[model samples]
Target: MTLQTVILAAGMGSRLGRSLPKPLTELSDGRTIMRQQHDNIFAAFGDDAKITTVVGYRAETIVEAFPAADYVYNERYDQTNTSKSLLRALAATGKAGVLWMNGDVVFDPRILGRAIALIERDQSFVTVNTAKVSDEEVKYTVDAAGHIDELSKTVSNGIGEAVGINYVSARDKKAFMRQLARVGDQDYFERGLELAIREDGLRLAPMDISDLYAVEVDFAEDLERANLYV
Candidate 1:
């Protein structure tokens, strides 16, 4: 099956203090964060990967940079959040399961290799870094069955940090889409996942990639750390 990959790039990223879309921010390796992501997808999936970017908050810039990519525009980008942007992409894509990531993350390419089996098995999952759990980042807790029970920035005593990369199996796509639609405008996509797990019994496994480098560039310091891995 051809892998469908989406990049959530609609956020204004005001915290990063960049005029350009956060995904377009340059890394030390000369590739923009999104560019690195694009390369990683292609490297891991080869020609079997289809890429679609959800663009807003300077959508033109991201579109112009990657003319080959498919795009879905988020008209209420400034007013909405990741849940809406991700909803738009999911609605626009085909029936295949999707692998998606936040636009600003710079991660080790090997992480994708690690996820291939899960994708092929049609397992829904979130990539996590068990080595660090920061308050500002999205955190997760597992249920008795070891499935993701809680997911959000405010999750206390979380086992790890969700690294902004995730996959939704085709089997769970419609259920997840419904949950996403029910979320509040400003709620992150994690809220939708939480609802899906609670209301629909969606089992989301947490894939630990703590041994690999994955940084969501939300600030100058984050960019510095991501650059170190680039």
Candidate 2:
């Protein structure tokens, strides 16, 4: 499979109150967060996997860190959210599908390998964590048939938290992008996925990743928790 990676790394980590861009922040293992994602995805899929990173805040710094990754700059990154960032990155991909992730996520390389294997089997899906969820986490619910019925942070009765790791297959790419482009800058990429599901019959079932560790770094506590996991 041609596993292309599109990583959204544009946001300034203002919530963390850090001067450095979030992706440039060093983790407990001494690898910068973006470097870790880049290294691990390549490790999981081999060097043949094309890596594309969408950058804005301190984009030069990220480019310096991983020159090998194809760069897509989100000029309106400050005003836009994941939906726009992802759309811009996807355009640069020129592929029918891609393995997408947030730049701040810290996880086991095997998770990437597992996600790819799952996509190879099913062709499309999103990673989910069924064991644990918090009010702050982006949650999702799968129907009795195991197709994702709803996905958003406001889903109070969710069955799992979305890990922000997804496989967009060639078959679903056009509809996915159409929904993504229909959204406003304030909306999340999840909104686009939801639109795709409702209007385009996109079925992004939940692939359990509860057996693996994956944490998105958004605050100091999250950073601490991620370090401990690593």
Candidate 3:
């Protein structure tokens, strides 16, 4: 089966204080954040990788940067959040499972390598960093069976932070999309995951990548830290 990847790049990223889209911000190694993501996806999946970027908040800039990627525009990007952007991409793709990440994440390429087995098994999962669980970041809790039970920034007693990388299996895609549509406009995509788990019995797994570097560049300090591994 071909590998499908989606990059959620619709946010304005106001905290980073960047004029350009956050994904276009330059990393220490000279590659833009999205460029590194593109390269990493290709490096892991080779020619089988099919990338679709959900664009808004200056969509033209991202389109111009990677004309090769399939594009899905979020018309309400300014009013909505990652939930809507992710819904758009999931709706646009075919029946295959999709691997997606926040566009601003700067991650080690090997992280994708670690997820290959789960992807191959058609498992739905979220990559997590147990080393740090900031209150502001999305966090997760597991069920009795060790599957993801709760997911959101507000989750209490969260085991770790969701690193913004995730996969929706073909089996669970329809249910997840439905939940995404049901969530509030301003909610993050994790809200949809939470609803899916509660309403549809979606068994989302948490894949730990704490040993590898995966930073979501939300602020200038985050960019500085992400650059350390670049």
Candidate 4:
């Protein structure tokens, strides 16, 4: 299957307060956070995956980090969130359904490979990267069947964390983009998708993953933990 990756790198890194995009932040291994993720995805998927990074805030930094990759710039990144960045990139994807990922994360490439394999198995599905949540984790409530039942960080009512990776078909990707273009005003990726699924009744197939220690870099504590593990 021909796969493309959309790495969402549009955050301003408010908690880091470094006056730089989160993706450009340095990692322990001397590689920038964005460079590590780009290399991870590229190394894992190889020629099969054409990677596109959705950039904003310090978009130039992201571009400099991975000039070989395709990109979509989101000027409204400050007012919006992940979904908007996704929408911009998805639109630029034109007719291909690809994997969606977060830029400010540290994880094993095998986790991404698992999700890609699942997508290749079934075209009309969504494979979400999941991890066993700890005290420092953002938990997602997964049903016995492995579908995400709910998600929470402060309430501790979830079973796993969303690793910010998914495999979707071109049809669903187009539909999602269309819906986002219509009413993605809230700018939350989850909210836009929930609206589409609830109102439009789009069914998303779920794949359960167990091969990664994925950490999303949101705050200082998350950065510390991610640096240590991923």
Candidate 5:
């Protein structure tokens, strides 16, 4: 099956204290987040990569930086959150089996390859890192069978933090979108995934990446750590 990768890039990145959109921020190696992501995805999927990005908050700059990507604009991005931005991008494509990623995350290509491998094994799951999870990180809980039971920042004493990357299986796409529409504008996409998992039996799992390095660039310090990982 063809997989469409929709990156949610509409956030303002106020926490990072940067004027540039989070996705446009450059790493120490001089390559921007968008370029790194594009290159990684391209390397993972090659010519079959169908990448689409949702742009807002300096949308033109992201477009100019990654012109080859199919673009979807979220005009209400200032009021809405990543959940709305993600749904808008997915709605535009109308395709099943989507690969989702947060715009601010930087990781090795092996992470994407591993995610795709899990999807091919008929599992829809999010990548998790067990290295260290801060209080601000989004965490999840997995049952004895490895199925995710809950996902939230308040998920204390659970598994590691979420990597903000996931696969939505074709079987769950319809119900997933429906539940996502019910989420408030000021919510992350994980909220909808939780709903899909609990209400519609979406079979969402957690794939651990404790040995791998992946950084969600929420602060200047996180960016520095990500640079070292590269």
Candidate 6:
């Protein structure tokens, strides 16, 4: 199966306070967040990568950012969530499986490689990269095998950190879009994916990830600290 990787970058990023989308915001090295993310993806897959970026908010900013990568706009990004954004990109491509990610995350290639390698080996399996979260960091719950147990937004107590990346197996484009549309009233993509796993009986695998992992940038402080790596 061919893999189409879509960067979910539809949010306005009110927390970053930038006039630009958070992915368009400049990293410390002077490279834009969007560029950094794309570069990492490109380095991983090179010519074999079928990359498409899902843009919203300042969609033009993303258009300007990855002039080479294909784009699909999610105009309802403000009201909806990443699941909807992902659905838009998936619909644009008539493919079977997709590799998905958050544009605002700071990740190393090893983490990305772990996820991609799983997809290449197992056609029907989903890969999750989870870290052991610190007391002060964002939290998630993980099953014994490291599949995502829960991405509780109100997760004040947990030991796992979701790496914000996955490879999805789509039965059909329409079915995936219908699943997304069904979850329009929900929070983020995790909720929708969970609902899919629960209702549609989807089971995912875990990437060989350890405690230290990528950080998704949401606030200025996160952007500031990520500066060192960017």
Local accuracy by lDDT, each model: 0.95, 0.86, 0.94, 0.68, 0.86, 0.69
lDDT of 3 by residue, 44-152 (tens): 8896799999999999999999999999999999999889999999999988899999999999999999999999999999999999889999999999999999998
Error of 2 at 7 (Å): 0.6
Q: What's model 3's lDDT at 150?
A: 90
Q: How many angstroms is residue 118 displaced in model 4 relative to the true structure, after the best TM-score fit?
A: 1.5
**Candidate with more favorable, higher TM-score: 2 or 4:** 2
Clashing pairs in 2: none
lDDT of 1 by residue, 1-230 (tens): 47899999998999999999999999998999999999999999996789999998999999999999999999999999999999999999977799999999999999999999999999999999999888988999999999999999999999999999999999999999999999999999999999999999999999999999999999999999999999
What is candidate 5's lDDT per residue for 84-197, written digit by digit as tens? 898888788775688889999998878887777777876788889877777898998887677888888888796689988888877788888888799999888889989998
lDDT (tens digit, per residue) of candidate 6 on 68-151: 888888878877778788878878877567778888887666766656656675433333334455554435655676555555
> Residue pairs in steric clash, candidate 4?
140-159, 140-160
How good is model 4 by TM-score?
0.83
Weakest lDDT window of 10 consecutive positions for candidate 2 = 115-124
Error of 3 at 124 (Å): 0.4
The C-alpha TM-scores of every prediction are 0.98, 0.96, 0.98, 0.83, 0.96, 0.84
Give model 2's TM-score versus the native structure. 0.96
- Model 2 residue 196 CA deviation (Å) reads 0.4
The parts of candidate 2 lying over 4 Å away from their true place are none
In model 2, what is the error at residue 126, expressed in angstroms?
Answer: 1.2
Compute the lDDT for candidate 3: 0.94
Following a full C-alpha superposition, what root-mean-square deviation does model 6 have from the true structure?
A: 3.0
Q: What is the lDDT of residue 197 in candidate 3?
A: 94
